[model samples]
Target: MKIYKKGSLYLTEGGEMRDDLINIYKDAPAIFETIREEIGKVVVGQKAVVEQILVGILAGGHILLESNPGLGKTLLVKTIASTTGLHFSRIQCTPDLMPADITGTTLIEEVEGSKHFRFEEGPIFANIVLADEINRASPRTQSAMLEAMQEKQVTVGKNTYRLEEPFFVLATQNPIEMEGTFPLPEAQLDRFLLKVFIDYPSPEEEYQIMERYTGHAEPKVERVITRRELLSLQQLVRDVPISDDLKRAAIKAVVSSRSWEGVEYGASPRASIGLILASKARALLSGRDYVDRADLEVMARPIFRHRIILTFDSERRGVTTDQVISEIMKAI
Candidate 1:
């Protein structure tokens, strides 16, 4: 349990420092499985989607979940909060939602017969925040999240408050409903580490969902990890290494997207950094201490899909961002 001490030296079999590495490589997956098992008990299936969310968490990054209604975008994030033993808060985004609604606003209060202004913290203070139907909110309201996500702090009336450690924003959006839904600005989209696309469940999975739901005794999930342990895992993931060749390849892949025929805009340099971080998290989830080439390739899609924009001509031809990313993957 103390394997994560700051500077303690640990040696295995040959008295090498590999024990620390071995601990992460051997233990991370079991820890991951512990949470996945809990999630599987209630959530029918979306194994890949679940894994990508876990990758985002381990990478200490925010996630944007997009899918049509009833695909369980809400349920997935709520489950993550319950299983991780983290405090959860939700914001129902609307055109009427103001910056003060998400962040704290100063209010006058009377204490000890004296009137003074105090800052009232908002829902963004929790460890896990679900911004449901975020695109439905006006762009001005959406812009309020900019500072909170990037700085991990909310500023109001010249005062700033730091968010809790391990804080994560899991925002949801309905891809098909564009009426009155504001497309997230590029800068806002870039702030998210990965955009996870959810698809409808498989037939077999749908049957299980039906059976599990119609029962009198519904499913319950136990907390699989504590806040402290989750923080440690995030640190452990960052400690994983990558080779120069893989680094170059990742950059090359991102750079190639810039001039690709169908793309109006390509992923920025942030995509390269996100690609590396996410791949390392993937490797750690597989109980590996070093990221492999396969890890880089597997993470490319989720990290780049939202970052690139398809041209109007490409849209007219039915070209999609995912297809463009697929081509880049093959060439690199």
Candidate 2:
């Protein structure tokens, strides 16, 4: 499939070009389903949240999870890591957490009668990093992770270290408790590709959860796809055809969020880029050849939710950022 850059958007030829893209997308569901099946072995319910995380991974972006305690946010990340056969690391963010604690630290070590600085990598170096209760950490410590998330590398004492490919940071926050919690700054929030809001499970799902845990037999989860396969899938998503019309619509929708009434700040250009990237992944998951308006609409909530800032007036009226974004989609 040949992609041509026209103006600020990418377009592909209509007939054969579309078919090739569709074929690649069709193959994704099989792999995605296999991963879902593996995750199901350990995780009882919350299929929607799991799907969102998969989308983020395929899109090669990070995720921010907002949910109440004991909703299995950490378990979901762990399950994903285990199912994908990736190295998983968990960091418990706390008030006393320091930048060096999450990133690496440089220590002096003597070698051959000479002292040399050795950099010890932290938990962020793993393939999958689950940052539990991220809001509890101090701002400085939180800021330290921003560079790693965006650039996929960490610089310690003038030495830079690149992270392994297929890196994913699934950070969770407790929404019910805000006391002594340092909210993530807007800049850091923008780095995340999606903000998934996990709600309570259904009655049937709750029963399944109870039954699954009550038994002494532990559910075994097998790896569905290797790390190399995931990396290849990410490349495929980038190569997926995106029509000019759909790209424009994505940009317009992101622009609308910023200028929309009840919003304090609109979505940035980065939000627009994120929407396009995420929409491509969503399209692939849905077995589509190219991104469409529907794909953009389906992905709008998670991509723009954390990017848009609601005004005080909107907050007073109980108007949420999602509502504002929904309105923009309708208007567009």
TM-score for each predicted model, relative to the true structure: 0.93, 0.91
Q: What is the per-residue lDDT of model 2 for residues 209-237, given as tens digits with 9 covering 90 to 100?
A: 99998999978888887887777678777
lDDT of 1 by residue, 251-308 (tens): 9999999999889899999999999999989988887767898898889999999899
Question: Which of the numbered candidates is closest to the native, going by highest TM-score?
Answer: 1
Model 2 regions more than 4 Å off:
1-27, 111-114
lDDT of each: 0.88, 0.85
After superposition, candidate 1 runs with Cα above 4 Å error: 1-26
Lowest summed-lDDT stretch of 10 residues in model 1? 11-20
User: What is candidate 2's CA lDDT for residue 182?
Assistant: 98
Candidate 2 TM-score over all chains jointly: 0.91
Backbone clashes under 3 angstroms, per model: 0, 1
Q: Please give the lDDT score at residue 64 for candidate 1.
A: 96
